[model samples]
Target: MEIKFEQKIPVLLEKAGKKGMTYKELSIKCKAKKEEGKYFRLAVQKCKAAGLILEKKGKFFATQSKGLYPAVIKRLHKTYGFAERLEQKDEVFILGSKLKGALAGDKVMIRLSKHTRGNLPEGEVISFIEAGEVEFTGIAHLTKGGPFITPDDIGNFDLRLEGSVKGVADGDKVTAKITKRGQGHRDLRAKVVKSFGQATRAAACCEAILNLNGVTPEFPPQVLEEAKFLAQRGIKHKELLNREDLRNEVIFTIDGADSKDLDDAISLSKYQDFYILGVHIADVSYYVREKTALDEEALRRGTSIYYANKVVPMLPKELSNGICSLNPDEERLAFSAIMTLSKDGKLLDYDFKKSVICSRVKGVYSEVNEIIAGTAGKEILAKYRDVLHVIPLMKELSDILHHNRKLRGAPDIDTAESKLILDENDRIVDIVPRQRGEAEEMIEEFMLTANEAAATLAKKLQIPFVYRVHEYPDGEKLNVLKETLQALGLPAREIKGNVPSKVLSDILDEAKGKPFYPIVSRQVLRSMAKAKYSETPIGHYGLALENYAHFTSPIRRYPDLTIHRILSDVVTQKRSASDIKKRYSEFVGRSANASTEAEISAMKVERDCEDCYKAEYMEDHVGESFDGMITSVTSFGFYVGLPNTVEGLVRIEALPEGQYQYDGLMELKETHTGNAFRVGDAIRVTCSGVDVNAGNIDFVPAEPESDENG
Candidate 1:
């Protein structure tokens, strides 16, 4: 077989060694005719442009000789960018001049420079390998050279539009496709393809954000058809063959009152010292079979994104909220994990089975908490009368499990999560901190037990499966935590060296009920690594669990669905360990990676979209003074979070005219007045300004009472 000229040029150049060869000499070696000479020259040029071959003083050599590394542009700032080396730990900092028009997420080859900015190595882009995003969503402005777009992600740079943009007026949020690639930001050209309404509206900004993240509430026609068919089919009698029937059991689901995708349900029974806890998860894998349209779409989505009042589900509502949902009194297919645990919450033994269950009632968390608190109204009591006997047992088991978690030294780090209360017109009327009550914690503990059991079974069987893993925190972040604690005059003794979960737990315990408890909790959370899905069971640090997997919420989470798919073969099909491993070994790794990426994307979308909603709400509250605590301090400003979970930045300019020095972690001190504003400090601030499109809220000190130290 003859090699294509483009492919052959790189191989031939590489084989020529460090001595290199001239273009004319290479052409002669190929014995190219006059007509074929032009094609050979083109191949050489392509190879050189691709960073496969380098030309120095008319001599050609492979790029390896010059030590060019392939990297992905991780982030781009106004004047600089950082490229993370592929499959490597190091990141290269590229100045604006060295970037060579590379954008964030682009793959490129770079030549390392001798210079270094602190510990980061400096590099220059040599050649492009692949373009990351050809389209971007941003606010368009009418410039002298037609309309230009200022992208949401890329800062301070305007992308010039090619030709005239008809419908995209000034301040309209639009998505533009790159029409011409360039060697610099100034040369890049794009055309507006679509536009949301005015950028000033939070709704318009949110739509663009959702589009940019590839999140949609709409399902494809094929996936919808598949879901519709499965919903209509419902549960067939023949499909229940060889499955355990627990339809008569007093099992029920507990979720938010407005939640539609009810997936996991539970039942509890006390037998002397052991509690037979039944966790029945909606068997989504049965309906969303492998390689089907519904399954593919779910895998692509990975997890449902919930922002404000809306949700972008992983699966269609036909499955998520219809037949596959564990609705009250509905006989639904389920994967049941019946665990026999000691009264002290120790897992004695567990059984995983393909089962059918009829949830007796839809249990609301608030109502369950009221029952436990003896605060339930007559209506609430009557609603839960059927499963009222099991509520106390759940509370008892939850207390035992909570004690077990505390004993195992799992840090109880809590962050303030906001719930945007939207009006009928979808405008935010209030932003309140979402509180997790005892009922929520009980459900969480129950889910954790089932997840651990699932992972334990996979490990016991030695089968390939996805595990929810959270590795230990980085040593550098721990050091920062130690310094911050010491600076705050808190105990830093246990934060040294290899810190355990118990030490952090102790720190939080000491800080509990203190004015700075929120900041301490936030700092501890910041010091921990993010929990993600993995094929390898490395353990979860936050939960202090050795074995864990997402075995619940298969209706919304792809990782849970993946777990169900693998376990179905083991429990339902009764497949051998060897067979299961052979079938899913490679598939688990791919699923884990895809699930993690999708989860990250969903989280970003949720956070960004929620910020816009919050900003929109704050727009109506400008000029109002509110007492808030400093959650974090940056060089430019300190972020103040109100009790309602509304956070705004107190910019450095808003402070008294003085030089302010940032301690680099959480404190900002006015050099002149010796007044220090640190994380956890309380202050009264007035909402000064808000940029709804950018989701930025600005605050200023209120009156004479500005800074209040904790």
Candidate 2:
């Protein structure tokens, strides 16, 4: 007279319907079997306790809801080469057999079975919970009857195009809109919305990347109109009348040689026993205002995106490059942070204000670096001599500030950056490494000082503001990194808890001058979480600062503009604490999410452009072997970076005439030969093929006997 646990599930599922049911239903569903009352109630209690059933509405139901077919769900571990089943209260399984065409990032519904003691839940994918295709960017390949688009980036599903849309010829890059999603057998349908010419590979790649990430560079027409109006009514003398005029101050802007949209300027002078450092940033919010088309558009875009060869500005060009730019010899409105510091880099006093300033000179980094190195050209040195006089002193002060930062646990990560040099035709001529010199460091140190000062002022005023926070690395990730480093014969201390920036800095310093330095440093950095803008005051672990915010480049960053507005309100004492708190809290929250998304989108476009350039660079060097470092380790293969900073994958199957095994904890090695290849290991690899269309580099390890033969 015992009621079985399996017998009640179907009856419960019928009651749950599409809305779903809860755990208590199981007892009621089995109540009709009179003599088995105790057993039925006990089974319900056991399932609830085991997290296999959810309790709702005095009913018992399976955790994954009751109506759908169940299959076990597992995450595809790309690095580990295995699917690890997920365990959670609401767990359901998606049967691999029922995956259909669903790719990663797709949400699916599944049914669950009775929980087995001490074993994983088994389920199958019954139905898709959501459809994922939003947009696609790729090249249109036209056939005689119709056109098909092959995706150039992620979201790999191809689309079929009709005759009208198939006007876009083969090799023509296009952005397509997802017209209809496929059900089971049919592929998703799309139509070409815009066609970019086939000649520009970098632009095509950028568009593809943006499409893949669900970001677009199109500006609203209303926003464009608003920008035009702002451009026409440029900053006037009347606007400067009531503001603190620092026009006569020796303020100057330093940027890249070809840079536009100058956002910040710096001035320094002696005031009694303190050095008065003025950091003036473009007051974008002043003109754009709140809730206007310009402001809303800026909020939507979040921040400017600077690709290698092009810039996708957050604001319209008329505003970002004209009115809001802190151009030399023009009176521009700005939100200024004036700090009084002692000779030893201690903050004594500070004032933030909305002011008007005129930049006396526009300096480029190369010119300043040459002048600081005492090897300036005559014309350049003459034009900037007055400003250049303080270059040496500023460099020394920057060194002092940098030293203090290191002592306080700031990481001096020496990651190299590369620049793409293009000719008049916009074709890349060379890939050059950009060195960090004293001039660059001097500017960076002062900018960091200004940003920290602004953040401190905002905190003291108890105003809500967006802070650029870098949290500590995850302990689990650090453990894996430590184990890998130890396997490479490197000393690694267990940093399994809250590791300070100083500890990471120490590790980085110790790894310098070694063959594995670059790879290890990159791996350690990868272990750390990404720095992001957030409303909450999470400390920045990378800089070892408690409060940090972006306050320098309002012309490029929306948060900086927001900071400018808050600082302006604080200086005027015009708003009550409660009002400021309420207004800025909402502003910071929205800006934080938007800025993070925009930053990620910008990086994608940048990296895509870099890959395009690298692919072009390798076109001429196919079949040549080069010495490289194994930069990344993955189950599928290892990525090797040549001296030019171009990375290619050496697949496990491509190992030199040996069966290779990937050790999860250590590295890759030959099964029979016992030869090992760890991350950061040096190896000579021959480039076998260059898939320019796919932006992939294929490499094969060079045999040792080939070296001897040569």
Candidate 3:
């Protein structure tokens, strides 16, 4: 197998890299036997499929289309779109009208727009490559000829029924699937795939929100059966062979009060001037092996989505919340990362092990916060008796680690989250800030250490691995970020070529305690590159880490599961270097690409759901006064973010009648009055209206306390 892979893949690419060759000529030049030539052909096909090579005129060659490449269209609103080219660091902008009716999230071929030659690259989407199945859920209305559906997405385009409708009527919530896309002036035609009850019901509305973003609540029968079988099989003694038995260890899991899909547990002890920290993650790979039905479904989900009211888990509950969950007093299989850190939190040494651990208690974050505060109630103290000494030590080490990262210039932009409270009727009753106390930060510190250790180990092994990498943000994003920094009182001279990550950290520090700090932090966060699973190591810019990967939550994230499978083979199974590389080289490339797209989709779904709930909540608060900060200023209007994380718009008309101009500094200025509304400005406003169907809110400025219409 080694010789076959090397000769066919590496050697073939190496030869073709020098010069192009036809299939017959390549085999003869490599001096391979007739049987080996067939293997060579298969290898070329794999590389081509994996996008490693390109073919033309019956000849094979290495892929070298470096500049101005085909990309998936990510439209910003309905007016314009952007695509980050494969070869360039900046994104190319395409006007929506020039898109020829291509919708957002569609894959299309784009090239630099005609007559474009400057630092900022402009592009035009010339053709639609694929529509991604483009299915949506919405209300279906009966017309004279047939049925039509109004989509629930941000897009307002309507679809006409392609066939005779059955089981669905006017105002019925239904899932419409696009079989073919419509061109300009033509209405989109679709088929009703599934039907819920009336679109007015909250259940149908919420379910439509999920379906609109392509999240299905149900899994395939095969995946469910596989999960059930794995749960019933149980952890056998043979499976526990060559694993550590840490059942007697005083370990515990700390998570949100309502969290049930637990996956990690912590154990801590002091060893002289060092601390022994053990982070044991559920061994999800043991049950959902590679190439299985369960694994396929998990890969498609990418990460477990934490919705407001429910969780759309990557793995079925039979595995995620059953045997794989680190429930208290249950002997569960886990992959342990045991590290010895100095008193100052520098990792001295570390080792990985496959183990069986039984957590003494599943401590909730709130209760643990009380324990850390030395204000534990009798019930809490009694419940945590087995590991009362461990909480303080965990806190100490966590503080050390947090300090260490701060010293390394890691940006501290961890924002407070809002916990939505709902009554029994599924109506939002209240929204409160879910503050992250010592317990939550402590777990985060430990998990970051373990993830870094995992990445470092995989790098040393020299095998293909998935790394959680955050590259430096570039192009127009950096330009606005500079303006934002200057807005935070940073000297314009401080913003220069290749702005260091520490600079962003310093800016965030300066903005702290200011009313605009949240929006500034949010804008900078948007300016930074999104962290994603990569097949290669790209130093994480945000965390200021050289090596990092998602290794803590395998039960929820697919990348962590992939890393665990590799760790099991390299560390425990002691596989050879070549064997590991050959087996996972293709996997690393394919899974990284697929998982990244899946994760982006899941995040969109979660965002849309939250927006829906917020709209529903504010439906009652219309005309009420509240304070909000302007998050962003655009040509049409400025967006205001409220305390509950709900954002809405105050249009340009609300300002003085003078023509408003958008400054390079990201402020909206009235040309005659010279008055401006800049980002991070707090203003009072009354909710004017709520477009629940579109998840939109309108805000009109409220009068000042001293002046009625100032």
State TM-scores per candidate. Answer: 0.92, 0.84, 0.83
Per-residue alpha-carbon lDDT of candidate 1 for residues 512-593, written as tens digits (9 for 90 to 100): 9999989888888988988899999988888888999999889888989998999999886668778888889998998999
Which is better, 1 or 2, measured by lDDT?
1
lDDT of each: 0.87, 0.73, 0.79
Clashing pairs in 3: none
lDDT of 2 by residue, 616-697 (tens): 6676788888999988777778989877778899887787677777877547878898988878788899898775545678
| Top lDDT prediction, candidate number | 1
lDDT of 3 by residue, 492-577 (tens): 63654567788878878888887878877887788788888899998798888999999999888899999999999976767888
Q: State the TM-score for model 2.
A: 0.84
Question: Which candidate should be chosen as best, given TM-score against the real structure?
Answer: 1
